[model samples]
Target: MNNGAVIFAANVDRVARFYEVILTMSPVYVEPGLRVIASDRTELVIHGVPPQVLAPAASGAAPEPREDTAIKPFFVVGSLAKARDMAPLLGGFVFPPEREFTSRRFRACNACDPEGNVVQFRELLVSAI
Candidate 1:
């Protein structure tokens, strides 16, 4: 089975764009209110926030980060160094290299998308040997 996540955003395009720039994935589908980006093992569905769910302050220009939530999706990337540099330009933030930690097979960091949805990012540390 292909593992995936569905993220809701005030601006679906912007959120989807952030993931596109950071992960090694391209959009499989796109529309004003929804987007689907996929890789070999992961897929992300970016959907527009429903009006009932949108906060009055959650404007499309700058969204409040929903940091207090419990769920945080993780993505495997090609390089944390590259993500760090690029995230800011795209209205997102990736934790600094100092915050990184290494697992048996990957180096990982925390990150947040343009709408302030918290997530984690990891890159391969070594191949199985």
Candidate 2:
């Protein structure tokens, strides 16, 4: 089975666009308050949250990251360099390379999405030792 995940947000369009840049996932389905974005090997769903429930945190300005959540969404990315470059333009922030950690096969960095939801990005270590 394909592993997929959902992100519920009050600013679905902005968040979807942010993911499109960082994750390189294109929207296959778009509706009033829902969007499904997919790359060749992975799919992610962004569902709309009730605006009254959680007011959006930011617009073009960088949001104060909300990292107090229990579950943090992670994405395997092509390059942290690319993500680092692209994230802020989309209103999100990926911590700099200097703050990364490496596991057996990947180097990872923590980030926050456009709405300040904590997320992570990982890039494969080409020469894993």
Candidate 3:
């Protein structure tokens, strides 16, 4: 099955630009409020959603916010260190990369976009190959 993900953004254009830098690839498709970015194996669909839609009700008696529904997409990178360093420049944040004990094949880390949606990046461990 093909793997893909949809990300909601407060500003489509800004988010698209941010991802373009991180992915190092231009979008294959772009519209007024949507963009489709693709890698060799997967595609990411970024959709623009207004803050009001995601915010609590205007009524004084609104329920508490619900759990987040954002889906984090895992990306493969050539170097986790470099990717982590570049994240902030591209309007994202990457925590330090660390090797997993269970999966010694790669070093992985978590990152977040400008809108606070998390994504993951991993670099294969050449020594483990």
lDDT of 3: 0.67
The residue pairs that clash in candidate 1, if any, are none
TM-score (C-alpha) between model 2 and the true structure: 0.92
Worst 10-residue stretch by lDDT in candidate 1? 55-64
Write candidate 3's Cα lDDT for 73-98 as tens digits: 67777876777777666566676544
What ranges in model 1 sit over 4 Å off?
55-65, 127-129
Mind giving the per-residue lDDT tens digits that candidate 2 earns over 22-100? Answer: 9898999999889989888778889998979878866778878887889987899899998988998998989977999
Q: Cα deviation of 70 in candidate 1 (Å)?
A: 1.9
Q: Highest lDDT among the candidates is held by which one?
A: 2
Model 3, which residues run further than 4 Å from truth?
Answer: 54-71, 97-102, 127-129
Candidate 2: residue pairs that collide: none
Prediction 3 TM-score vs. true: 0.75
Q: Estimate each model's TM-score.
A: 0.84, 0.92, 0.75
List the global CA lDDT of all models: 0.83, 0.87, 0.67
